[model samples]
Target: MSFVAPWFLVALLLVPAAAAVYVWWERRRTRGAEPWATAPLMPSVTRGGSRRHRHVAPAIYLLAAAVLIVALARPQHDVTKKIEQATVMLVTDRSGSMRSADLKPNRMEAVKAAASSFLDQVPAQIRVGALAFNQKTKLLASPTTDRARVKNALNTLTGAGSTATGDALAAALAIVRPQGAAGVQTPAAVVLLSDGANVRGRDPIALARRAGRLKVPVYTIALGTDEGTLTSKRANGTTKTERVPPDREAMRQIADASGGTTSDAPTTEALQAVYKRLGSAVAEQPGKDQLTSLPVGIALVLLVVGAGVSLRLTGRIV
Candidate 1:
C-alpha cells in the first residue's frame, strides 16, 4: 500500500465538494414541491424510472470522477530503475578460529547467514562479489547481479585452516577491481568479515595502505563479543570455548587505513542492520516508475464513458 504520486491525494477534496454541491442541488430541486392546494391530486413524476437508480447514478458518477482524478495524477505500481550500481566485494575469513560460538550457532554459521541475507537484500541491481580465506584466499564468485549464486557460494565456506586476512583482501580486489578505462567511474569497496586474527603474510597495515592507493574502501563487519572465547577439540572428541582473547585493535587498524567503516553486532538483528547499511552503500542505483500504468488509465476512462452514457440515457425522456 504505497503511492508513487502521493501529492495526488490532495485531489480527494474535489470529491467531497462535488458531493456536497450535488446534494444541495437535489434539495433545491425538491423543495416546495407541495405548495399548491391541489398538489396532493396533481400528477407528480419522479426523476428516476428505476427506483434503485434514484441515488445510484450520482454515486456512480462520483466514483468515475474520483477514478479519473487519480489516473490523471499518474498512479504507478511496483516499478524500479537501476542507473548506477556500486561495485561491492566481500572478503570473509574461514579459519579455524572463525568457528568460535561467541556470536550464535557459531561464528562461521553467522557469517554464512549474514552473507546470505545481505545478498538477498541487494536489490538485484548492484554488482557484488564474494571470497573466502584461510591459509589461502579463494574467489567464490565474481562481480555479478545474480544474488542467489553469490549466496550459494557463501554456503560453501568451511573453517579448518589459519587466517590470511591480507591475502584474502588482495585476492578479493583482484576479482572485483574494475579496469578504470571505460570512461566510467565505478567506486569499489570490500566488506571484511573476520575475527581480527591475522597470522600470515606481511603487516596488514601495509596491505591497507595498498588498498587506499588502489582506491578501494574496506568496511569491516566484526563478529564477536568483547569477552568472546575460542575453542579447540582434540582427537578424544573433547572441546571447550575458552576466553583466549579479543583482537579488535588489529581489525580497527586495517579498517581505518582503508578509509572505510567498521560495525560490531552482538545480536542477529544488529548484524542484520550492519549488513543492510553495507549493502546500501554498495548499491548505487535502484529501480523506479517510468510512466503511469496503462491498464489503470484505461479502466478509469471506461468508467467515465459509462457514467456519460448513463447521463445520456436519463436525458432521453426529458
Candidate 2:
C-alpha cells in the first residue's frame, strides 16, 4: 500500500495522545473521589461490573479515529485485474505426425478437445485466434472474442504435410503484435502446440527471440509420447513406420527464448490441464486500486457502534 498524501498520517499521533489524556483524567478523578469515599463505599460509588469495561467504548472511538486518519491519506494497493482486451493466439501443428494414436483417439483430436476446453475457460472479453501449420502455414482465425469461429477453425483442421513450427509462430506474432505498428496493442500471447520436430520451416529459436523482442510470450506445449509412432504408405507400393516423439528440448528452447513456459502434455488430460492453467494466467495483469473508501467505511461503522456502546454504558456519547 502507498498513500497519496502521506503527511496526513501524522494526524494518527493524536489518537494515542487523546487516549493518554483520558487515562490521566480518569486517574485524577479517582484520586479526588478517594478523599471522600472509603474503600468499602468505592464499589457503590463507581459503576458496577468490571471497571475495564468502561474503557471499551473509548478504545473503539480511538480505533475509529486512527482508521479515519488512515483514510485521509488516500491509500492505494496493487491488484490483479483482468485485462479485458487481451488476445491469445492458438498456434497448432496440423502436420502428419499429429495422427499418432498415442493419446486417446489421436493427437490431433486431443489437441482440438484441449483447445476447446481452453476457450471455455478463458474470459469472454479475451479474443482468441487460431492458426494451423504444416509445411505451409494458414491463418484459420484472427484474434476475436467469438468462440464459435475459432472452434470452427479448430474442427476443420486435418493433419497433413510436414511440421512448420517457426512459420506458425511468425504468423501468430504478426496478428497479435505486428511490426512497427502504432503506440501499443493490448496484451497478447501465443500458445503453440506441436508434436515431432521442426523440419520444414523458418528457424523456430530465431522466431521465438523475435517474439521476446515484441514482448509477446509463446507458451509451448510439446504433445505426444516417446513411444508414439506413425505408419504411412511410401511412394514405392510399400508401407513404412516412423517414430513421432515430441521434441521437448526444441519446445523448451522456444519457450525460454520467448520468456514463456514450456509444458509436456504426454496425455490428453495433461494437455487440457495445461491449457486451463494458461487460460487464467494470460487473462490478468497487475493494477493499482485506491483503498481510501475501504478505511472510510470501516471508520464510519466503528464510530456508530462506539457511540451506541458509550450511550448504553455511560448515558452520554463522547
lDDT of residue 39 for candidate 2: 88
Residue 253's C-alpha lDDT in candidate 1?
84
lDDT of 2 at 256: 99
Candidate 2 lDDT tens digits, 180-261: 3467767888999999789976999999998888878899999999999999998998999999999999999999999899
* Winning candidate number (TM-score): 2
TM match of model 2 to true structure:
0.67
In model 2, which runs have C-alpha deviations exceeding 4 angstroms? 1-79, 179-181, 286-318
**lDDT (C-alpha) at residue 241 in model 2:** 94
The alpha-carbon lDDT assigned to residue 39 of candidate 1 equals 41
Find the candidate with the highest lDDT and give its number. Answer: 2
